[model samples]
Target: MRFFIVISSLSKLLKYMYYIYTHSSMVEGKRCMQTNESSKEQKVKVSGLTFAQLKKWVTVDLGMKPYRAQQLFSWIHLKRVISFHQMTDISLSARNRLDRAGEITALESCDTIAADDGTVKYSFALEDSEVIESVLIPDSPRLTACLSTQAGCRCGCTFCQTGRGGFRRNLRTDEIVAQLYGLQSSSNDRITNVVFMGMGEPMDNFPALSDALSIISDDRGICIGARKITVSTVGIPGGIEKLTQLDGQYGLAVSLHSAVESTRLKLVPVAKTLPLRELKRDMKDYISRKGRRITLEYCLIAGINDSLEEASALAEFAGDIECKINLLIYNPVEGAPYRRPDTESVNRFMHYLYPRCQAVMLRRSRGSDIAAACGQLGPGARND
Candidate 1:
């Protein structure tokens, strides 16, 4: 049996190795993966950081003046330079210091699966040897990258595949930023939008998530507008408060899978601790301050939360908060005792909510081919 297990692990590793070989692009006489290896541990100067806590490196450690840091910031954030060698105008010695002391490029792309519908799902190995998944969905003119914030989720939402695996560790800011860079670097299509609706709850990994967002929204490099990035949380009020204090505009989405407390507790166990009332109040306060529409994400489960009464309750909940509603048809996961809401039932739920609040059916990109769809991330069980 021990020998059998060893063989099984070896086989799985070999399969993943083959996948990486087929997916990785070779350029300039070096594989992209090779460059990633060289910079993995460099201190990663924070002068013009897009995400994570790199500014401390500039202001505190680097001993550089604020203006110089600002300039470096612009070069790194605006220019999106992958290496310090690209900071041409800076002194060679200073550039060398940065190159040796600092580091970037954390997420290493292990494999990519491109769906027929122009959706691309990527698996990334984090610095700590854990894997997370991200998805890029192309909708004609607008392209959105769905990024994950954690290796696995602890929230344990019954319908989510990642949740079933239980929570691991939070991703570093660089890990988060690396996902965006990986997708943008490989694909011809530029990602115009981003969503924190991936493997882990954004609130669960607040510091890293916020740092990543700041960098992504920075005007210097990747320069993705703050308004184009949406951070989705499983209703963590404290994290929401921190977000509201930010200066620029960014969107928020709450996963309120069910309206009733009893049902919600079963669907999302964290609901018992956070509760819906406090979450609704905080959301209302945020909306009143920002004047931007808030989105409530409701995943409709067949015969569970899709009944007329539940729909009515959901519509009423939206009316009370004066927020927009995005209803997702539940994605089936292995061993999860849930089914997608039928189209007719989904339409009826939308019909009920439209009068009370802005409601739209979210068309999700299916990615079962690569096991990269919603609720489809986690280490799979060993096959016999």
Candidate 2:
């Protein structure tokens, strides 16, 4: 009876912890919403707003000069300053006024790990104490920063560690932008490329992602060109359409783990409603409108989606569209049932896929030893 009571108490404690961990973000969001509902003069979070929005906020809302917005924007984004006092050129009085009327928000970097292969993973704590990860992959000329769009993930891809962790909350625009700037501050190299392929699905947080893209690509600020950034999605509904409507030519990569619809359904559960046919149509539309080639990412998992027939199916799927194929080897994750294909299987699969694809490249897996590879990112994946 004593042992059973102890076990029951432990179970209840675990359940309570899980509830607090998962629901805090949402509860905090609701609390903020309620607090802000009645207050019209609440301080604006300056980090996330675009220059135009900042200009309006300063001039109309704060009764300041328009050019100050440019100065503030450059400081918040280019300089990566967290406090208004860091804006050296701005008049002390203006800085004081800005501090009173608005605030610069930033993600707190909790843990960092550098892999043997020069892949650095950064873990950040959100306001609600939810944890998310970003990765800095060093590619000499182009240091790429992998930013997360949401805290956890709603798209339950069976092979992805992030998906298995389940959903927490969609990150705000500021949180999305802060990841790039956060990584930039930590590394010696300025990020030349940005990939929204870390903790959450980008399309699920489209509004924030859209705003972040504009701010990141804007010449007035951090100014990483749209072409240098890639937004990867698991083919969520209306996501491609929304991207098509956006102004910039930011690159798009689809996580097409399997070309066979049935297989994809099993792997990426989100693909059930948004089938391969619909996804193809959307991709075609994006190419037609954007005039940019798409990138198809295929992770070869042993006995899952890695086979001669799978390659054939992939070739057939890409045959109609203009896209480059990036074949990635499945990276090992704790508690995942999937296995990386053996050397012979991978070789055979690539050989069969090479000529059939519009363009084919076997992307070398990076940071697998440190859990920073593709689809191997999440809060639980962090060493700390």
Q: Go through the candidates in order and give each one's C-alpha lDDT.
A: 0.75, 0.87
In the order shown, the candidates' Cα RMSDs to the true structure are 16.1, 15.9
Pick the lDDT winner. 2
Q: Which stretches of candidate 1 lie over 4 Å from their true place?
A: 1-56, 65-68, 362-369, 381-384
Error in Å for residue 132 of model 2? 0.8
TM-score for all predictions?
Answer: 0.82, 0.88
Model 1 over residues 86-156: C-alpha lDDT tens digits? 88887786676666666546455797777777777888887667888888888879998989999889899
Q: Candidate 2, residue 360: CA error in Å?
A: 0.8
Top candidate (TM-score)? 2
